[model samples]
Target: MKSSVRAVLGLAGGALAGLALMAASASAQTIAITDGRILTGSGIIENGTVIIRDGRIAAVGASVPVPAGAEVISAAGRVVAPGFVAVDSGLGGNEVSSQPEANDLRQSSNSISAAFDLSWGLDPWSITLPVARLGGVTRAIVVPSHPGSSGGHDHNHDFAGLGASGHHEPGLFAGQAAVIHLAEGTEIIVQPRVAMVAPFGNAGANVAGGARGALYTLLRETFAEVRLYARNRAAYDRGDVRALSLSRADLEALVPVVEGRMPLIVTVHKANDILMALRIAREENIRLILDGAEEGWMVADQIAAANVPVLLNALANLPGSFERRASSLENAARLHAAGVLIAIKGNEGSVHRAREARYNAGNAVAHGLPYEAGIAALTVNPARIFGQQQRFGAIAPGLEADVVIWSGDPLEPLSQPVAIYIRGVAQPLYSRGLELRDRYRPGQQPGLPPAYRN
Candidate 1:
């Protein structure tokens, strides 16, 4: 967790490390990873050995004994920590957004089905998956595009021209999000549906008659319809269900949201909108998580008071719209200082840069957030927010062995992982990008330069 400290990664002939890199798939033998600085999220332990057996962490501490017949992997001089989690990633569903054939999921729809699941489109062997693991990211939340992003649509800029545009398509909701492991092979999804995604702020206002009041009314009415539909299931079967704007499938998909089983993640900015979202959550007794709150620093106290978490792109410091005029590099620091829970998210697309979660944390640290807090934002905060903390976010005994051994301070882009594990099993170090790098080297017949040699 100490970004200033230089980690020593002795990896000339790490036999166990080599074994881990080459044969990181499932194995019958016990695994012991020793001699590394372990970041347990809750705290840190220096020179720790984490024992793993049967896909879970068995023991983790500085002096924990390595079990008999364990395949020992020495992580001497490396940073051992829980693998990073990139929330709201668009990985596995597509390799490139512009390419029609490479991508599987659809985008830019006016009213996408709320039941549209991303797990079915996941390409488990995506070329980007291994590279994400190479960057020390073991877990990710794959999400379809949010309908409210300001990238593709016209900004509803006539509202006093503060740069906020309340322009959005009518009834556009992103599909459900899924949690997946970055390990090789198949069965990528661990949780098929973690949250119900929707829009708020200017985007929602655009969709709901160009005003915040109307937007809130629409959301309330939608929830009421979902409730009525759930209560009168037999009536719906008999064609007696009340008329609703959303289809039955989409309404059914939202059942968990109202029942408090799944959270509703809304993309919103502006201080007033954030407060209004909180008020709606309170009134409905529903779980909520706010995303893209560029002006969140203005309402940090209110967020902490509500016990709601915020997900954001830590690198977002510029005012892209009127609603986000208060955006700054210190936003993350300000929120954390006020006791607000914060999680860092990454860019979402067919070619995902979600692995940049650590680098984004580094940026937050550079702007005043504590280094440990930055690490927590990438590791445990999202897991805690998304209800996956018991298994995916820590290096504790009985937790899933999704750990990483870093060559240096993980926040630094120059550094990389020497070994990676998901569910107690080491992952292969190879990636299609690295293979292309080797294949396209400048020199073949003779050595042109060290950088270009075969």
Candidate 2:
């Protein structure tokens, strides 16, 4: 009886091991898309075959051959393009803007500005991600709305002789931004501290003593302090250094910005303000990315000369504020014509509706931007701006397989993504909204009340 039991146990263990091997083999399977209208970002291929292996593109050409045992997808009448990369997205940071528990985009009353990392607040399972993925957005650059609350807080406390008042104001430095992948599952953050968000222009001026000049003064002074903090960290930590306006944490965060290692995403709109940001970038010798450049078209030449990239909302054609009086639908077209690198911003400030960035690119196209340039703005431009171009921006050989098969012209309002592959793995075209719609359809009836139904 004991011998028979041992034999059965051995067989069971062997069966489990075989199943595990099978699962591993399935996960490593190659994927191929054949006969698709491939937009390679650099150019277009009428009909090509893209082969993906080990989560990267192995081959891409008109006559590329698919390997044996590979899962093949026919895109004969579809559009195959690189996945969209959205900027200024609030994905994984907030679900509902008004709900405090679900929102993590801002940190009001926190003494730690610049040092606050948004990646800590990321929720991999955020409902908005699936919806964005369905729209072909595979990556994003997430930023904070602002750091401090509208109402100022008292910061009279000191850390190692660091002054709590004046230049150490809360709203000066919003916080660190992050780059993320919209893929499902636990691993979502691609790079933390990708950029430091600094609010500028009208609202920022209000925070800095109600004058734009005052904000620039604070920026200069803050950078000086950052240099001092970096040069004498031991003295500062020991409380032997002179009093500074910022906390130790904030100072540490600005070290990268001052040293030119991290780019600063300055939120400015007016043409003058855009020039001012460029001036500061030169003066401080730091990299800069201009966001919300409503009047960027006016300074297209200057911006292009400086070789700085702009992130914009193509639909921002209205003069919503004094700083945006020069806003135009052709802002993107004018900038692109001047050789400026630009990326499109989403319609929703947060990740909930970030998919609308695709349509924004379409609007730009209608307003004189080239069709190919519009696609590049939605994909390669953002990835390049955030130092992610080499990984998955374009549909090229050796790039990550973040490819999308579209039903038609992707920029068209009615077109949809037929399939999405992130890291060479097929993603489910599912969203919570779809489930809710199906559950509450006109003809559907439930045994229980709507709220009580599972």
For candidate 1, the per-residue lDDT at 143 reads: 68
TM-score of each: 0.88, 0.89
lDDT by residue (47-92, candidate 1, tens digit) is 8988888889899998998777666777777788899988767678
State each model's CA lDDT, in order.
Answer: 0.76, 0.80
Question: RMSD of candidate 1 to the true fold?
Answer: 6.1
lDDT of 2 at 289: 94
Which 10 consecutive positions of candidate 1 have the poorest summed lDDT?
Answer: 158-167
Question: For residues 376-421, what per-residue lDDT tens digits would candidate 2 score against the true structure?
Answer: 9999888899998889889898898889878788899887876777
Once fitted onto the true fold, the runs of candidate 2 whose alpha carbons sit more than 4 angstroms away are 1-28, 147-167, 445-454
